[model samples]
Target: MSKIIKKIFISTIMVSTTFSLLMGAESIEISPSIDKKIFHEQYVSVTVKLNNKNISKVLIVTDKNEHYPIELTTQCDNVCSKIIKLRLGENSIRVEGYIGEELAYEVKNELYCASQAFREYKEAPIKYKERFFHTDKNEKLCAECHDMSNNEQKKVAFVDVKDSNCFVCHKAITLDRYAHAPSANWLCTSCHTGEIENKSKNIIEKSKFIAPKQIASACFSCHDKNKQSWDTKKHKHFPVEAGMCTRCHNPHSSDNKMFLRVNSSFLCLECHADKKLSQQIRGNSKCPGEQKDGCTECHNPHASDYRFLLKSPHVDKKIDNNIKGK
Candidate 1:
């Protein structure tokens, strides 16, 4: 009985020691995983997993032996990712891990940059199928459009509006779509001026594209006539009165009519959340006589002369105090 107990304790000690040795082995893993060879975008986010936690530095070595040091915020426990810019053709990258001056571990990855041809290949991963807005053609010209300087007083979204370079690559925004008037004219600064009113709630600190807190303020600048007309109406939609126009509308270009985020009925029901209306629209209700045309069949989205923002008079029904009325 004493000999059996001693043998059990010895086996447990040997197993624990072997497990610790395997866990401490140094290695590096690179991804876009070697099997998926092609990447649609020039800039690819590569994740490196380090089994040895002591590695203090990470670097990418190109096939030509050019070493680019990657800045790590901290010595990562196991994983760190960086956006690496790849050359236009077949390329090889070696992700190397180091402790101070000495190399610790390294892993190699191969990738092909074929932005245009990637869309036609159906087998490509969904992430790599669509070409990113900032592709190879526009990669180098970022400073041309963006405000690169850190001047506190003169910081704007773009460097200059006189020769707007946005439309050069973004011409597809207006192709066969109902473009917002300002977007059609390439006057992006009308909304995104990188300056907002001091008191506005949507002031994002260090924002890449500075837009107005009150989106309606930008819309009313051009649509002053509509604002003046809507202001006097007896009934107004909550979002419209509160100047939250983007709740249902897309500020940028949209394929939908009137630049709606989705079809008017679906957009209206999203906020209204009436079980009866939702069931009727979805065709799941047992009640047969349902109006499929949706909320606009009775209620106007923005403002109406009648009660409940109705397109026609609804004097037969009782008024609800919860709804806003002039």
Candidate 2:
């Protein structure tokens, strides 16, 4: 009887040790799903299915340092969800886990926001129709952008030969970088048609398919451009070639010269944030807002034709003026 009691006590101790070890080695898993694009709204909804427990806190943090508390849809499990308000451009959403006031781990994702309406086929919003004035009028001609008949039967394939339909309206597309591959050969469908869903951030929803929503991935698919950790130029403006194409150039329409959103001078100032430098650039010690020479006066916005992306070589200003006049 004494031996049996001793054996039972040892077994209980082993079971308790095993249970504690299992509890201590807690692992957390989160499955996040996002809609990539939100229609006419500033906020996007995210559903995060979590396989975690003992989470003292779970918060959704944005790139702008805005924190939003995530609430579990069901207490029975860790399925959580939230609606996050986003800025105009790229918005990074990070999920942070905390255990009893202690920081645990963080998972991050990204989504984009734009007032640009891409969905006009199934449900045409008044604003979207107004924006694409021509496309709205030509709504009868489905073949211009999509195939209404089952002859092609593709989920998102466009009419093959009429790929230049976009060019009909956007005649001013800049040939910068010699028309990047995806844009070349008019295989617009390859980049425009969605692999799974017929919706992407950049593409207007047509049939059952659309282009890649993420601009960078759509570009890099054939452009061979990769994001580098460091900028190694004589004068590198971080945003240039930063895969933020729409920042400076209209992706489809070359409304502004050089495919620029605005002239380089004015565009640069938007982020330069240095009033003194703007004044100095304009040779104005008094009024910075009034520019004497735009950014092109000295700096080459695209490349360094002269040193440090300068527009001209270092020479006496008077001499150059005299030479030009002569």
Go through the candidates in order and give each one's C-alpha lDDT.
0.60, 0.49
Error of 1 at 83 (Å): 15
Clashing pairs in 2: 192-210, 192-211, 193-210, 194-210, 198-209, 201-213
CA-only RMSD, every prediction: 15.2, 17.4
Candidate 2: C-alpha lDDT: 0.49
Best by lDDT: 1
Model 1 spans with C-alpha error above 4 angstroms? 1-141, 144-163, 168-176, 197-204, 275-293, 314-326
Q: What is the TM-score (0 to 1) of candidate 1? A: 0.46
C-alpha displacement of 257 in model 2, angstroms?
1.0
